[model samples]
Each structure stands twice: as C-alpha cells, then as structure tokens.
Target: MSVTTKTDGAGDSALVFEQRIQDLCHDELFEQGTGSEVAYDLISNELLLDGSARLNLATFVTTWMPPPAGALMAKTADKNM
Candidate 1:
C-alpha cells in the first residue's frame, strides 16, 4: 500500500507506524518461514505483547498479506506436482 505523509503534518503518526510495520515485515524473523501456523502464532503473540500500535500492525499484515501469500504458495506447489 502507498502511504504518504508530510513531515510536520498531522498524519505523521500514521506514517511512522506504517514505516515501522513495513520494516518489521522485512525483518529476519518474518523472512525465515511462511505458512506455518506456529510461526504465525508466535509472531502474533509477539506483536500483541508489544502494545497497541504493533498489535495493529501485525493485524494489518496478517489480514492483508498472509491469505494471498498462502494462496500463491499453494498454487505454486500444485503446479510443481
């Protein structure tokens, strides 16, 4: 998603949050694996423990990203069979 924010404007908080979340998703923790419920649960717990902002970030990613990624991976695996 595209996020735009002015440096000294009111939306700065949202912009920062989005940037932080984007960074988190690109971190090593998320890079190690995908599609494992154990991994998802662990990540979810970690974010939820981090307070509301991080929790929201985790929720956003989980809701928006995982399903499509899972579907694509499944399709690829099926094609390879």
Candidate 2:
C-alpha cells in the first residue's frame, strides 16, 4: 500500500485519513489496524443508536444531575474508577 500526504486546512499532515486497509469491525478486531480516526468514528457511529442516559428512566444509577456535580465526578473519574 502507498500513502501520500498533503497539508490540511490546519497545516497538519493529512496522511492518517488516507488509510487504505480499513475493514468493518465488530465481534472481532480488524486484521489490519484502522487508524485512530476511523476507529473512533466507527465506534461513535455505532453508539449513535443508543439512548441518552438522561432519558433512560429505568436505570438504577443517577442519570440527571446539576452540571457542577457532573463536572466534579468527571474530574475525579480516574480516582473513582
């Protein structure tokens, strides 16, 4: 495979988006690794069908809260995990 690079609008090399070996990812990992951008885009697209947590009333865990508490939790997420 060949990769050619050009500067993007942000002046960063656009070669990563030129990935040519990508395949659909599902229960198994791709035999050829897709670049991070493609992987993230696919995963996020898959998650688009999922319902928003705040709209799920049956969940036992807290879903709706003030912004400050959510921010605090987000800040300390690594420690909490």
Candidate 3:
C-alpha cells in the first residue's frame, strides 16, 4: 500500500507517511526486534487510521500534555490499577 501526503497544506512535511514509516522501521532500534515489513505496515496503517496518539485521551499517562492538563485529568486517573 502507498500513502501520500501534501507538504504545503497540512502540517505534514515533504516526506510522505509511507517513507517516514520506512525510515523509522529501518532505524537500528526497531530493526533489532523480530518485527517485519508486514507488522510495520499493519501497525503504521492502524496508527494513521487512529490519528495522532497524542490526541488519544484514553491512554493519558503516555501522552505529553501541558502542566495544567494533569490537574484536569487528575480526577479520572487510575490510582488503584
């Protein structure tokens, strides 16, 4: 599957999503794992479909948000689990 992105319109840069994924998959860190092209494509496609991980509010701990954002999220935080 081929993925393309516009450079001038959105915040995306010249490098398309597929190229970026290829670059990331080629990185030494990820290459050391047993993951293959099929896995990469599946994961990357899912991420693209899911939009930005930073925008996902369900998994708040891993996201990078503003300092005040913590206070807002504090009430819903899972302290027991």
Candidate 4:
C-alpha cells in the first residue's frame, strides 16, 4: 500500500512518499533557483509540521508578552541586527 502524508497544495509530485526526488539538498548548494514562491511554500509547509506555539502554564510570564512588544516584534521582523 502506498502511504501519503501531505494533505494539500504542492501538486501531483510527492515529498514524503517519494524516495527518489529530493525535497531539499543537504550538502551541495543549488545551482538553479526554483523562484520565491516555491521556496517560501516549501519552508512554510515545513513549519506547519511543527504545529503552533503553546504557552506553558508554569512559565506563563516567559511566553506571554504585552501587545505593544508583540506589535513591535512583528514590525521589526524583517530587520537585521
């Protein structure tokens, strides 16, 4: 039986099921580009597998931040240190 993991998006090509096609290259750098949308989609889908962030009840202070700080973070997300 063929087992499939990915539910939607991506297209007919398989990432989890297919052993031949490499979803990502490990050692070697890509000689060609797959465009911004394709690269973003691949990363975004990978992050989805990690699930949403959850606050620990015992360390609520560490996880919960003021709305102002959160807004600031969101606004400055693109900035480099």
Best by TM-score: 4
What C-alpha lDDT do the candidate models reach, one value each? 0.49, 0.57, 0.51, 0.57
TM-score per candidate, chains pooled: 0.22, 0.33, 0.24, 0.36
lDDT-superior candidate, 1 or 3: 3
Kindly state the number of residue pairs that clash in model 4. 0
Report, for all candidates in order, the number of backbone clashes: 0, 0, 0, 0
lDDT of 3 by residue, 1-81 (tens): 559632333322323444544434543464234334445555666668655546665666555778787777686555412
Instruction: Give me the displacement of residue 42 in model 2, in angstroms.
Output: 0.7
Query: Can you write out model 1's per-residue Cα lDDT over 20-68, one digit (the tens) per residue?
Result: 3332454345434333444454477676665564344443555455677
lDDT score, residue 64, model 4? 74
Give the lowest summed-lDDT range of ten residues in model 3.
Answer: 6-15
Give model 1's TM-score versus the native structure: 0.22
TM-score between candidate 3 and the true structure: 0.24
TM-score head-to-head 2 vs 4, winner: 4
Of the pair 1 and 4, which is ahead by lDDT? 4
* Full ranking by TM-score: 4, 2, 3, 1
In candidate 1, residue 79 scores what lDDT?
A: 45
lDDT of 2: 0.57
Identify the superior model by lDDT, candidate 1 or candidate 2: 2
* Winner of 1 and 2 under TM-score: 2
Error at 14, model 2, angstroms:
10
